[model samples]
Target: MKLTVVGGGSTYTPELIDGFARLRDTLPVEELVLVDPATERLELVGGLARRILARQDHPARVVTTADLDAGVADADAVLLQLRVGGQAARNEDETWPLECGCVGQETTGAGGLAKALRTVPVVLDIAERVRRANPDAWIIDFTNPVGIVTRALLKAGHRAVGLCNVAIGFQRRFAGLLGVDPSEVHLDHVGLNHLTWETGVRLGGPEGEDVLPKLLAEHGGPLAETLHLPRAVLDRLGVVPSYYLRYYYAHDEVVRELRTKPSRAAEVAQMERELLRMYADPALDEKPELLARRGGAYYSEAAVDLAAGLLGGGGSTYQVVNTYNNGTLPFLPDDAVVEVQAAVGPQGASPLPVRPVDPLYAGLIANVTAYEDLALDAALRGGRERVFRALLAHPLIGQFEYAETLTDRLIAHNREHLAWA
Candidate 1:
């Protein structure tokens, strides 16, 4: 099968290439196209991709190009991993929000809104191009603000599914702690993208016995430590929250921590420089160890599984993905995109029925879903008022003063990207 990666020039591409090479039995990729506007970075990443595949004896042909249409043309599946404004814009997204005394994150709060606005339009344009090229192709979005971007693609009637490494990362961790294979640990993962909880950890299948309590009873400390949350909180909540939840559960503390550290964007920029230098080494045939510190751990596995399932190849039957809720959460609108465990196939993903959500998590999910609605509006029809309203609606920046300030800063820092601004 043919596959295309729109942001194949990203430092993260080598990790993905490694996965495609190793998991050839799962996805069986033939032609692999790397599409990027940054020609220099694309060549560097492309060369490493080819070497990695060849080293593994995988026969996928690696092609690199700046033309989006040509790169995606007739592809079986197209993965979107592009950053509309690169790390510099991300630095602004992570920095300016902290000035409002709010959590500075790329996927939630004011910063997430900025990313959604900048990303949605670009993703939609690419989706349209892919649609024109191959109407049957599935669009797998690995971009940040995935819920908003995936919503944009689906609303525009594109065949798409959103993938995140969070669920797979959790599964792998839980499996290691439980002394079982990752596939045997099924997470009752639910909620919106980046804002989710592992309500249960079942073994064998979705209907398998729930071992979450056992996990918490034995491994709560390490789990909580990974989430950067106190063990007491996990015991009290009785569910493992994603690390991103730390931003919400400890907003002020997170903001304080963020203020003291360099933006994640800055750190990643430095890592990318080193990674590029490494990627340029002709002898480097594998993803560098330093790339592990660059994040998106297990992203390759998740992408492979999702793409395989979507294309009717051998893949995990059930996986966590972001797709239309379709009433999986009674509290959320059916059209709202939610991240949950779903049975994936050629027909697409259908989220499993979830037990009644506790009011604690349901309330927050509902609140963020509303914020995402406004974020998408501002992204689709940009205006100062729309941007301000979206920021005002976010649970993290609910105050008008903070919202107004963040809105102006967002537009100011991103004026070149926002067509209406």
Candidate 2:
């Protein structure tokens, strides 16, 4: 199979290459294309990818190209990981929201909406090109604000499924805590992407015993620490919220903490500098340990499992993916995309039915679903009023004054990328 990565120049590529090499038997990619507009980083990252594959004796030929059309042509699957304006833009996304007294984050607040507005059109254009090049191909999106982007792609009728590592990361952590293989842990991961909780953690299979209460009873303190949430909150909710929830649950405190530290974008930008320098070393044939610190733990495994399952190679894997709700959560519109555990195969992913949701979580999910509707509108149609409305709808920035201020900042920071502006 031929697989193409759109942002192949990313520092994260080696981690992916490492997975493709180690898990070669699962997906068996014959050709790998690294597509990026930046030539220097592309060569460095692509060269390292080749080295990683060669070290593992994998036969997948690595191709590097600045041409998106050429890179994706006739490919079996295309992975979207491109950043619209790079980390400099992300730095802006993380900082400017603080000017409005909101938590500064990449995927959850005013910041995430800015990213969506800048990213959706570009992704749609790329999806169109991918469609023309290979209609049979599946597009696996690993972009930020995934629920919104996946919704846009599905709305436009593209064959797409969004992937995130949140569930896999939790699975790995739980497996370690339980002294079992990661595959043996199945998460009742539900809600929208990034805004999800682990309501249950079943062992062995979907029908296996629910050990969530047991896991929490013993590991609550450590688990809460991992999520940066209070143990009391976890005990009260009887669920574990994704780390992104910290931005919502402790917005003001997080804002204060964010004010003290340098922006996360700045830290990543520095890390990229070091990672590129490492990639330039001809002796480096394996993924650098530093890459682990770059985040997105277990992303490669998630990608491989999803691709293999969707292509009919890997049989019947239950994975967490962002796809249409299809009434899995009756409260959400069937067309709305949700992140949950599903049975994945050649036919595509179908979310397993969810147990009755508590009103506490269901209410928030419904509110965010409504905000996402408006957010997609602002992202696609592009008006100041639409942007303001979307911002106003966000639970984190519900007040009119903050929404108005953030809307202006978002537009001002991303004017070059936003055609309507």
| lDDT for each candidate structure | 0.94, 0.93
Residues 1-421, candidate 2: write the lDDT tens digits: 9999999999999989999999988999999999999999999999999999999999999999999999999999999998999999999999999988997887888999999999999999999999999998999999989999999999999889999999999999999999999889988898999899999999998888999999899999999998888899999999999998888898889999999999999999999999999999999999999999998788999999999999988633799999999999999999999999899887778999898888888988988998999999999999999999999999999999999899999999999999999
Which candidate number would show the highest lDDT if scored against the true structure?
Answer: 1
Q: Which pairs of residues collide in candidate 1?
A: none
Which residue ranges in model 1 land beyond 4 Å of their true spot? Answer: none
For each candidate, give its TM-score against the true structure.
0.99, 0.99
In the range 1-421, model 1's lDDT, one tens digit per residue, is 8999999999999989999999999999999999999999999999999999999999999999999999999999999999989999999889988887988888889889999999999999899999899999999999999999999999999999999999999999999988999989999998999999999999999889999999999999989999999999999999999999998899998989999999999999999999999999999999999999999999999999999999999999999999999989999899999999999999999999998899999999999999899899999999999999999999999998998889889999999999999
Which portions of model 2 show Cα errors greater than 4 Å?
Answer: none
